[model samples]
Target: MGARRGFQEAVLAIVKKIPPGKTLSYKDVAGRAGNPHAYRAVGSILNRYDAKKWHIPCHRVVRSDLPAPRPGLYFVYAVLCGNGAIYIGQTGNLQKRWMQHRNGTASDYTRRYGARQLFHYEQHGSREEAVQREKWLKTGFGRKWLKREWKAGRTRQAGGTPGGYRWGSKRKLHLLKKEGAL
Candidate 1:
């Protein structure tokens, strides 16, 4: 937490400040960390971030040249597991990935927490865009966006619970919103 002077510490601290659905290029993070020319160093520092720790959303750091994703080939998807968990993922081959999830071979998280129903999916321009979008969908902003979509009737399902991260089914979410309980 004391990264006021240490470059590595500063880089991480700055990265932790990046909001969900928002991003900063590697170079931008380096500059903010007090070293204008250490973009590579920022990447390396982020590489060391422990996945076990919180407040480090390193995936939000994008390449300097990318102006965000464009629009087509790849996909970003969300699945509603039986336990009320929403899993977000990206894939170039949507059908293949769907098969994997169905067979419980996609991820341990999905296998253990979800029955694997395709609740939402969106198109992206490339693999990079899919990856970034997957990360975004795991954030609060993405959830709210989905909620808005539900409200607009473009979608009928979503994820979130009152007391914990695990939410109920699509029907439950809809009822909660209707009764103004959510």
Candidate 2:
């Protein structure tokens, strides 16, 4: 990879280390990436991340508040749904919540969706921190901003495995075989 792409990949590698049920602000990732003050740049990189449907799990990186994105939270919601992440009652108990999801004791949203693993996570401190951040994410042009990029295909969804970029679904494959369309 080129130097810039290499740096970005290195940044994303650190991002992928964040555990489930946790969160991190853009500043957090920037600091971790050795830039310390590149929060806006980090946001820009994340927003323009093209490998979402493949190698990167950008959905887990929220604005520290874990707020659902706008245009109805479908991208985040669908991803979370697709992963079967359970809802934790307390943000402070992130580790415990993640364990529940890992162990298959997650919330209704997670169960029906068959989401089980956390591909990435970010640490956003306490419940208060998460709530405040969530509030900011919901207001302003957050939803519109996210949706435009999401619809434009920046955020790709993996059908069979988490972060895997295979283009076809097993069900689709099966149906095609049955119909002799393959």
Give the C-alpha miss distance for residue 42 in model 2, angstroms.
1.0
List ranges where model 1 is wrong by over 4 Å: 1-72, 156-182
Name the lDDT value of residue 89 in candidate 1: 84
- Tell me, what's the RMSD of every candidate? 16.1, 13.7
What CA RMSD would candidate 1 show? Answer: 16.1
lDDT of 1 by residue, 1-182 (tens): 45534988788788888654344557668888888788887767776666337557665555433123334588777777757666778877654565456445679976565333565667777788878878877789988886567458685232222211122245434433343222
Candidates in order have lDDT scores of 0.60, 0.45
Question: Could you tell me which 10 consecutive residues in candidate 2 have the lowest summed lDDT?
Answer: 69-78
What's model 1's overall lDDT? 0.60
Give the TM-scores of the predictions, in the order they appear.
Answer: 0.43, 0.33
